[model samples]
Target: MPRFDITIVGELNLDLILYGLPESLPPERELLASRLTLTLGSSSAILAHNLAVLGSGVGFLSRIGDDALGEISLAKLAESGADVSKVRRARGSTTGLTVILARPESRHILTYPGAMFEMGFEDLDLRYLADARHFHVSSFYLHRALRHRLPEVFARMKAAGLTTSLDTNDDPDDRWDGELDQTLPSVDVLLLNAHEATRTARAANLEEALEKLSKRTPVLVVKTGAEGAIARRGREEYRTRPRAVETVDAVGAGDSFDAGFLHQFLRGADLERCIAFGSLAGAFSTTRPGGTEAFRDRAHFEEFFSHHSTAEADALPSPKPAPLQAKP
Candidate 1:
């Protein structure tokens, strides 16, 4: 067996969430938040942590500063049972961090890319990467230093006989400029939200976006929030509706979905089952405050899984691709 089920090459950071903030912040004013929370953050880190919690042997590869914040980030990630042996500590740079001002309806995030921007293709150890059965990368836009080298990295991973996935997350610049054409072909699976899918494809709608992207990526998965998620492979497509739950926060739902999807996928589960488990995991994430909170232990994960997953759902054979239906 491979040493690890999955190896994640991505960023590591912390999220400082301040709740009950004013809708608008005026410059040069002191404001108080009714609540504050500091938790492990970054799309990649969340994915690795939650995946490890879900019983996957996960390994994380990234760079962080040799600072207190970095120490905290590393400790939190290690606490989640993910292998942090490949994580490097850069001497001069500090770890990345995001400050979130949580409003009633929406949240504003301020990010400092710090050492997250310092990692590059050179920092990646191919020997370490070879130990995993699959590879995943996230937050494409945030990795400034490694942006240009991703295609080569993906190619290397593919050459090492590893299935690969990419979650570009949100492009802060809104200019989805990268080696997507070269990179997508190497990517076995590509995960995106509805907005990201449309933006990356430059299409008018989600269906059109999937149609275009599916041509490049072998499998395309789109996270549609409460509507659940949809996936396409070749001409085949599958979708799963989200489960109803009392949502605490939607911070890392998408990453959690990725973890769920990949968890079943690594087990050789079909796409339909993967989508269902992915949706179930995404919903479970919102029942708690942070990404990995709900799956903090095996008991929580098993209890939630047992309560939410039906035997029929798990045993159902993969269904035929349904007719293309546009999002309403």
Candidate 2:
């Protein structure tokens, strides 16, 4: 058997979320928030952590700074039962950190790339990454050093006989043109939010974006927040409504959605079931302060899924046969 069900290559960092912050910040004034929660941040780490918690064997590889933040982030991910044995720590750089000023209905996210921008293609181990049933990449735009080589990474993963997925989180530069065109052809699944879909496709509307993006990958998933999520597999399309819950903050909801959808996906569930479970998982994330807090509570995690998942929806065939030995 392969060592992991899914392997991820991306960033690992910490999120410092401050609640009750003013909508607009004035330059000279001292602003204070009511509450604070420091937790694991970064889309890749969130998905890997939650997927492992959901019972999928996960392997994660990332480059981090040799700092306290990096250690804390690595430890947090390891606590999820993921293998972080290959995580690299660079001596001079500091780990990335995101400071979220969360207001009532909106949030301002400020990030210092730090070591996140330092990871290069040289840091990746193809054989290690390919020793899995699936491969996923997130925050495509953030991998400055490794950006150009991502297409090769995806291609090699596909050539190694492993399915692959990509979540091009957000483009801080707003230039949607990276190696995305080259990478899309090898991706079996493509995940995006409505805004990201529109932006990436350069479409005038969501409908156009969906139509255009669906053709690029075998499966296209667009996260719609409160409206739930939608998936397209060729001519067939599936959607699921959002679960009603008292939301604390939406910190890691989308990543949790990816985790849920992928967990079901690796189990050979249909798209409809994957979408529903994804929506359910997303709603559960909002009950806590950060993206991963709700998941950290074993009782809350199991209770939420047990109450939300249907027997029929939960029944999925076992994963497909593991991929062949990865080529060097």
**Which structure among the candidates has the greatest TM-score?**
2
Residues 1-328 of candidate 1: C-alpha lDDT, one tens digit per residue: 6688889999999988888878888999998898887888899999999888777788899999999999999999999889999999999989989888877688888999999888988889988887778889999888888888888888888898888999999999899977767788779999999999999999999989989998988889999998999998899999889989888788889999998898878767778877888888889888876676777755766777777657425522122212222110
Worst 10 residues of 1 by lDDT: 319-328
Per-residue lDDT value at 261 in model 1: 90
Cα-based RMSD of candidate 2: 3.0
lDDT of candidate 2 at residue 97, scale 0 to 100: 98
lDDT of each: 0.85, 0.88
Measured with C-alpha atoms, the lDDT of residue 55 in candidate 1 is: 72
Which pairs clash (backbone N, Cα, C closer than 3 Å) in model 1?
Answer: none
Superposed by TM-score, candidate 1 places the C-alpha of residue 253 at a distance from the truth, in angstroms, of 0.7
Alpha carbon deviation, residue 219, candidate 2 (Å): 0.2
lDDT of 2 by residue, 1-328 (tens): 7688899999999999999878888999999898999999999999999888878889999999999999999999999989999899999989999999989878999999898899999999989999988899999999999999999999999998888999998999998997999999999999999999999999999999999999888999999988989899999999888889999999889999999888878777778877877888889999998889998998887677767657434432223323333211
The candidate that achieves the highest lDDT relative to the unseen native structure: 2
